[model samples]
Target: MKEQLNSLVLKYQQTNDEKVFKEIYKLSVAKFHPTFNAIAKSLRASVDEVFALYEDVLLRCIPTYTGEGNFENYFMFSVKNKRANLYRDRKLRTQKEVLECCLPKDDDTSAATLEIISEETPEDTLVRKKRADQRQLIRSLLDQTDETTINIVEAFLSCERPTPTAIGKTLGIHHMTVIRKLEKLARNFDSKQFGDFRDYLIAN
Candidate 1:
């Protein structure tokens, strides 16, 4: 069954056959449902959300599989890394919301709603704005990097935090080379241009 699906993926990549692609996609969803369900259950995520992430992983990776290792293993690695990033983003949002809730409020205003608005300090507003700006800078810089560099950085940033050696093995580079490239990348993030992004990476 897996070999048949693998052939279908290759054929679809070659011929761009809508029917073959659809069949391969359907088989992928069915074949990986258990994996997705387990991840969703462990993360306390909605199954539908997890499945959507799985589908996205398929869209991005299937065309590039090239008959490499087990397709299931390849797909699993992609989806797992994607889920880790999703989890991290969700965690950051929750932390931001908690911080917002803890910000000091205004004391002098009489109307309750107006009082709430008046209570937030200029410093609090600046802090939130700076964070938003820093995130934008991070994304912009990530977009500017080469694909291989971006891949290495994303793998490093993922929840697994795979060692430089492990990442190097996956990317077929020397471990010291990976460390050097990351260090150079970090140095390129000038504080004048990136503001708190460099600090955020270091602090984390």
Candidate 2:
């Protein structure tokens, strides 16, 4: 996929053709859809909202992509920055709401509402803790597995509709082999703790 993306990116850069650019966009959507879904789940935002932001970012960055660094890394860095900006904006909005609630108002403003708002975790802190937890979980899983298993795990996570057959196809293995590997992974790590392997993948 990386090689394919690099080729497409270079072609687009050279041609500056609309069709080439569209193909690049299509490949990008397929490759990054899981990551976008994961981001939306983490932020407690709608998938459509996340996808819209992703599309906007891609449009803004593609023309400027110098094809110097790894394309995936460049794209992901932009995504992380955008997610951070979103959290910052949310924090500001929450602060504004808190201040508005503190202002003297009519009987319509309830103390319970103020208490709830005050008790909520700050957006930045929540995002930090979530990312930390995800990293720790990924590390723990990696420690318990071999490189082949890790490859399977990654392929499974990357699939838009992650079935055993799809994962096998991605890794050039049999479907039953994919299942066996997953079962072994499940034994090594408590997949059920995260509701299922799919949920664990999304969380991470």
TM-score of every model? 0.45, 0.44
lDDT at 125, model 1? 85
lDDT of 2 at 165: 51
- lDDT digits (tens) for residues 1-204 of candidate 2: 766777777787677665676677677754677776777777656665576456545544665578787676677688779788776766666566652235446776555333334544576576567556655676687787788778877765555446555567778887556645655665555644654433454332
Q: In candidate 1, how many Å is residue 28 off? A: 1.4
Model 2 bad stretches (over 4 Å) = 34-38, 99-204
Candidate 1's TM-score: 0.45
User: What tens digits encode model 1's per-residue C-alpha lDDT throughout 1-204?
Assistant: 778888887887778666786677667765766676777767656666675566556755765698976776677788779889878866765555422233336755544332222356565787667656555665666776677677776665542335455678888986555544654465567756545323433222
RMSD of 1: 14.4
- Candidate 2 residue-wise lDDT at 176: 51
Candidate 2 local accuracy as lDDT? 0.63
